[model samples]
Target chain A: DAGITQSPRHKVTETGTPVTLRCHQTENHRYMYWYRQDPGHGLRLIHYSYGVKDTDKGEVSDGYSVSRSKTEDFLLTLESATSSQTSVYFCAIRDSGRGGELFFGEGSRLTVL
Target chain B: GQQVMQIPQYQHVQEGEDFTTYCNSSTTLSNIQWYKQRPGGHPVFLIQLVKSGEVKKQKRLTFQFGEAKKNSSLHITATQTTDVGTYFCAGGPTGAQKLVFGQGTRLTINP
Candidate 1:
């Protein structure tokens, strides 16, 4: 295990509301990623951080923002939730020790009403 | 942008049957990795293939990478009830930082 934890295991928010999900890791891994999983879409990356204060957008970055002020914490925020944003979000840390393997946190299931 | 496509969006097999899923990419990849997500669970790393025409096996699961590095496959033998879930193949392009994942193949095993 990577000792990763995601806050708010489940959430139900109305469309147009703001929501933020937190990913905290205790392993001190250098790469952290945020992904959303939906039926038929697999897991799509939303954002990722390579180091403190260094972040980049991923394939499905629309309507999502991420921040990493510390090596152990990465946050993903939806400025305004949408019905289409309802999905299970996952946070993962690349295990360089094993070379290219990612250990994922327990996912966060978000529902937009 | 890179795209990884997986086939047979869904599959159902008897407990003792064999099952396989394929993943293809239009562009060549540097390395390919496979992940499995059990129902209601997060994706977990299963294996990573770095060299072309490479084949690796774990217990009852076998993973292979194409000669051109543009495709991959996972085959499971004597499937069991625990095999029910979705299998995803992901790859990163040369010098790319993020991985693109295939749509995945959902497997259902019947008793």
Candidate 2:
């Protein structure tokens, strides 16, 4: 929780609706990632950004879109929410090393009806 | 598809017992990190292993990276009730920012 805060920590939305989750970090870390965890599936990456406006797809990016317009802000959008999209989403920032540890924000729990 | 697999999906032991979790990556990892997540809590960073055949210790926790650099392990000696949580291992591939995580090993201590 150090510098990472996720907005709308808990959400309930209807299927086919558009929803966006916001992640803001005060640490100004260059690497930010969005991961969704479901029961028994561990944490699957949805999207990640290495720099402003530089984003890439993760393992499960089919229904998720991410935008990083600023250093501290990363937004993940579900173009159209679905029941299967319901899960706990976490925002993480990487430490500066060849490949360092991640500091995670409190996760966002989303429920799609 | 890089696979990071963790062994002993669940571990239950008496207080003061030792515990260990193993993580193996299908591909060689640039580095590996271990995290501990309490029930209903986000993961907290525990340690990072960068060099092959490297071993580090923190209090009762010992972390090691295999000489092949494709596997790692976390061993806790004389565990306590406070150590109840899920232990996760994440691996980062060379030139990649994504830290793909293993399924995690949940540890339970019987007090």
Candidate 3:
């Protein structure tokens, strides 16, 4: 296990509400990524951070935003939740020393009603 | 945009049977990585193939990268209940910083 932790392991919120999921890591990795997993879609990248205050949008960035102010914390926010946004979100840290292998956290299951 | 496609959305096999999944990328990949996710669990790294036409094996599991660097495959021998899960292939495009994942192939084993 790679010292990664995701807050709010499970959440259920009504549509149109704002939600933020947090990912914290202790490995001091340089790369952190956020991914959402859905049936038939595998794991789709949402956003990623290469360093403090350095972030990039992923393929599925619509309706979602992210921030990383510190090396150990990454945050993903859903501006306005929707039913389509319901999925399991995973936070990962890239271990460049290990051929850039990604070690993921336990994951956060979010439900939008 | 780079895309990775996987075949057989779902597969069911009896214990001791063989199973295989294929992965194809729309663009040539600098590297291909495989991950396995058990039901209700997060994806875990399995292996990565960086060289073209590379083949690697892990016990009863075998992994291969195409000569063109645009495809890969994972083959499991003597499937067991422990192998039931979804297998995903992610492709890192040449000079790209992000990896694109395939839809994945879900495996179910009947003991």
Candidate 4:
């Protein structure tokens, strides 16, 4: 219960369409991360933001981009949806004081047809 | 890239039985953390172990960090039906805040 929220809990889009998922937090955390969970891959980071307008690519950044214009909001966008991109996406905020433990949102399940 | 591997991808146990899952990392870790995700729910932070050969317990759940700092284990004593879900171990490398998570072990409890 870290006061994190993810919009569009579920989505289904056609291939080649653009989709954006939003993550909003009220805890005023300094670090925000986007991750995707698949059957065998587990949770793979796509992007992370350390501060407003400061972001970095993660292990699985291909075909995905992120932006954080404010401390409370982080956005992840899929430029062109692909079948391989069909997975559950999670938004997390790092608890700097707690051994770098992350608090995750409810998650968004996206399906590409 | 650092990789954290978990064994026994799937586990089935009867209520009151004991269960354990292991996680291994290819590189040394500065700290390790455990998370649990209930069925159709998000991952929730459980505990963190920083020092080598550290052991911590939360009721029936016991978490341990290996002496080498590259392995970790989560053991549940007298498993309950509520323990049905996936358990993940994430490792934070030395001098970095980023964490690499293990694939996770999905536990199914037979009521």
Pitting candidate 1 against candidate 2, the one with the higher TM-score is 1
TM-score of chain B for predicted candidate 1: 0.98
Q: Which digits, one per residue and each the tens of the lDDT, describe model 3 over residues B11-73?
A: 999999999999999899999999999988888999999998999999999999999999999
Clashing pairs in 1: none
Give the residue spans of candidate 2 off by over 4 A: A97-99
Candidate 4, residue A94: lDDT = 87
Q: Model 3: runs farther than 4 Å from truth? A: none
For TM-score, candidate 1 versus 3, the one ahead is 3
Instruction: Name the DockQ score for candidate 2.
Output: 0.87
Off by over 4 Å in 4: none
Interface RMSD of 2: 0.7
Chain B TM-scores across candidates: 0.98, 0.98, 0.98, 0.98
Q: What TM-score does candidate 1 get on C-alpha atoms?
A: 0.97
Error of 2 at A43 (Å): 1.3
Using alpha carbons, what is the TM-score of model 4?
0.98
lDDT score at residue B23, model 3, on the 0-100 scale: 98
Clashing pairs in 3: none
Task: Tell me the deviation in Å of residue B74 in model 2.
Answer: 0.8
